[model samples]
Target: MAFTQIEDYGVIGNLETCPLIGNDGSIDWCCFPHIESSSVFAGILDDDGGGHFAIQPSGEFESAQEYVTRTNVLRTTFETDSGTMTLTDFMPVVDGVELGHTTSAIYRKVTCTEGTIELDATFEPRFDYDRVGTTVEQTSEGVIARGNGEQLYLWSPADFESSEGEEEHAEATETLRADETMWFVLQYNDREPIDAADCAALLRETIDYWQDWTHQCLDASGCPFEGPYHDDVIRSGLVLRLLMNPQTHAIAAAPTTSLPEEVGGVRNWDYRYAWIRDVSYTIQALNELGHEREARNGFDWCLTMCHKDDPGEIGHPLYGLHYPPEMVEEELDHFSGYRHSKPVRIGNAAGDQQQLDTYGELITAIYTATDYGEEIFAGEWEVIEEVIDHVSGVWTNKDKGIWEVRSEPKHVVHSKALCWAALDRGIKIAEDNDFDAPIDRWKGERDTIRETVLEEGFDEELGCFTQTFEGETVDAAALRLGSVGLLPFDDDRMQSTIDAVMDHLMTDEGLVMRYEGDDGLPGEEGAFVLCSYWLVECLALSGRVEEAHDVFESATEHLSPIGLFAEEIDPETGEHRGNFPQAFSHIGLINAVLYLNQAEPGETLDPIGRGATEITTDSKS
Candidate 1:
């Protein structure tokens, strides 16, 4: 029903790439070799048509799944009328011989849990989403599925059937009479085969690998928690770190493909790309947990994507796997979208938009990186100087806001405040780094932005900062005005702004939306998960720790039973929407928990949480 809602899926990846595993035990969406490839198994889009790779008990089975401790090793167990079986999914993490953090490969294994149970495994490989077709060969080891230009080999147990174009009957039959075991191996052509006997041994190796790396945050996890939802906040941070591109150092939105924003709503766009606006919360989350690698990757992407060299040059509102300026947007007209949300696009059209707040986010990233003991890029600093100079010149002009609504542009308050913050942080950077910038010019522009916002951005009658200048509509984004420090939380404007957003933007579920009136689309969407966390953060910053914890706990109620968060949640049915296991949602949770902890010290927070906040705040002082 409703295409199972986007957020119902759990993510498994080898840093080089990721594949989403839905609750149904199917590999619903998977891109080979990288996060941005044609789907090999995409049951997430069409349960019947879209191909899938799954292994569970054939008969009726009650299911439970969890990641094994610190590693990405996933253990999903199914209890049926016959017996119980567990599927261990993971990406292989190899350390360089010299030591430190470096990944090599990933491996997924399936095993027998407590009771030996027969399993039904199915391998339906649909190359290129719709099916350009793969050359399937019955290898001595298993079925080697090969697609044109895609060398990913899918090896399953022998006896798997096939078809000419769309392979459907490729099933792994298990009779419950004895213990049955099966493994699916998807590997690039250039590597040697991994020696994995059963899924449990591989699961053990993967767990050790992740524990070794995540052990670095063992202390950070012990921080006092703010609410009942502490574990969720921490793991979200870990997910963000893993999603970042190690090569380009950019963080993609979700390591997924074609998981539509609206089910059958024709609003499906590829979220496997990065946006600085999204990374603002991401940076804060990583820094709080002391996760340096992901924090630095976020900063790297922000610097490259910010158009800091020419901030006024129609800044790229978003980016794909890399930060190339000319990366064009195109729609995949062939494949039907997840839940039939058509116009499945790979690149982002928001790249050329003028979201004024993005530069401010860039500033926040750099400043936070600096504060977290990270090295600032020499080239990026030069570009940032120019970008800050540009913001100083045109802080009042507005083209598009953060939501990137397709409608006409307006003077959005969030955009203006970020502009002010960009200049303010730039001034701080220039002073700290002893760089010669147009200081006098920047200060004047910053002053103007502050005054203009106080006068025009505030609604006197509503006693709060409106979404747009003097607009009555309160926005969930307004919660960031204080979070970004354009105004202090004690200010009446900031407090009222939070109140107005909560009063207007919130639904009965306690989640929020971007705005009330319009978002340029026709159908109603789910509650914005990030916006709700912003409310939690706002509550904490406003010295309402208990309230913030309460809100945070309420938000966690929407998580799928397996501890995964999505982009949005249904207002009525409480189902999740947008992409599954979205890093933005998790990062928001991490940052909010940090604010709650700062507000009050009560629950002992595990410093080694997956979503470590100290890492996001690391910078080069």
Candidate 2:
């Protein structure tokens, strides 16, 4: 099997879970039942033990892949020596508003568009993360691969034969002329077998469903985003939605884990779990783009996760998708890593670490969604108060920062700024709704946090706000002060800090690094993509419109062909690093575009809202 670069894959999902379909026609990585579940196909991580399902031309062929317009359905064209064939891939969904709640089946239709072409289909599933082998059993309907309490059934119109001894693997070879079509359906869990006609009908319905949803985005008239990357913005929004869990409305940071921040390095971590701070950022971006309903759904999901039976035991920085409290880190020693990036991790330890920034993120998300006139339940309001009380009590202490640093605790500047934001937004929420208690106390704490950040987080000698209190390390998080409303974007102090961070922490290739300081990690990582977008937003807000445009262009120049981005980018190689199709990166992109477009002179733009709260059309004229 030929291995492709991580960027060569396009993602297709059922809103429950997704699979990464490579340009070469391979489903590289996928987790079923839920995003965090063990992968049935882990070839993206370990080609041998990590089984894969692939359909491609038998002979050598050149291939190109793309998503069907306005939908998650993917189409890969294979040009063989004698002919051409196209493979259409999508997970089936029910009709209407129920489209998001999808069935556990992947529908693939293969057709020859040119002369006669020979096609090959391979089904190899790794059960229990390859801890056990799946035994393939042939039946009248098709073939079923069963192992470890998971059963994946395959039904195809073409003849199937056992490739390995004892029918451990199933393969099909068929020749089709122009206008000929064949169907393959891969079903997981409890599902009824379907025929080719039903598969074709479901495919059409799925395409229509996605197309209608994309049309509903803010792209209609009065939509603010009209720029060089308009289509990219829409596509990123779709990718973010694809990462969301339909049942809980909780969004995963990414679909895959252990893809590596640096090849041949140990920076791999599982990103399938939901992080409160990450979801909060995602919601804010969606809300700014006029996807208010989706944003509120996500925020409401976070509220539900935090509000357990015990109100005192409120929120954690991160949680598993199904099991919120038990995020135990585990290493898979049996499987090889992606391109030799070692120690494939399962769960995240960051869930247990006390990151003080989460409170502020939750409050800001709720306040932003509510400000958009979306209704908030009384139960949500109670959770908001509990979070506020928690922040007021714990802002002074620090365990882990936003980066989830494994180092000793220090007063991280970003965490403190977020704590201030929590109080600041809480006060605003209280005043806006006239629902209150401890108004003066909240005000004093907010002001105290502001003063402390100004005094201790800033380094006069360096002319920038440091990463931690009284520390000299410049970080990209400083650029976010404007977004959180902690500082005026054009304030001289803030400008100095931005300039300093860009000067010291940015790569020669114009990409921003998260931080240049050591955090007890072994290998060096790539420039952070989210931070690059933050620089874009910060520059636009500070009145450097042209510079911001230039920076935005440079930052997005090397994204995936489909405009997807990973968490980080290697400046030298221009390859995606860390988890692929990262939510934070796309969220940053959408918010930055909104900030730039809404930043016209005489028009005041709210960075959080991503649009003018008041357009001031008369002043513009």
**TM-score of each candidate structure, all chains considered together:** 0.89, 0.94
Weakest 10 consecutive residues, lDDT, candidate 2? 612-621
Name the runs in model 1 displaced over 4 angstroms: 1-5, 97-106, 114-116, 165-169, 175-180, 198-202, 215-228, 305-309, 323-327, 333-336, 375-380, 600-621
The segments of candidate 2 whose C-alpha lies over 4 angstroms from its true place after superposition are: 96-101, 163-167, 215-221, 309-315, 377-379, 601-605, 610-621
TM-score of 2: 0.94
Q: For model 2, what is the error of residue 69's alpha carbon versus the real structure, in angstroms, after optimal superposition?
A: 0.8
Q: Write the per-residue lDDT of candidate 2 for residues 1-621, one digit (tens) a residue.
A: 656788889998888888998988888887887678888999998877788999999989999888888788899999998999999999876563334556887888899999999988888888878888678867776778888899998887778876555327888889999999988888998658587778888888888877877625445466767777778888898898788776677788999989999999999999987888777778767765666667878877867855766533433577766654458899999778998889999888877777878777777777766767766566666767777877788899865788888888889899898888888888877776777558799888888887888888888898988899846899888776667877766566778888997799778888888987789779989999989898888888777777788778878886898778989999899999999899999888887888888776433245754221121222111
lDDT of each: 0.69, 0.80
User: Which candidate number would show the highest lDDT if scored against the true structure?
Assistant: 2
Q: Predict model 2's lDDT versus the native.
A: 0.80
lDDT by residue (tens digit), candidate 1, 218-253:
564475443565667556755775677767776778
**What would you estimate as the lDDT of candidate 1?**
0.69
**TM-score of candidate 1 against the unseen true structure:** 0.89
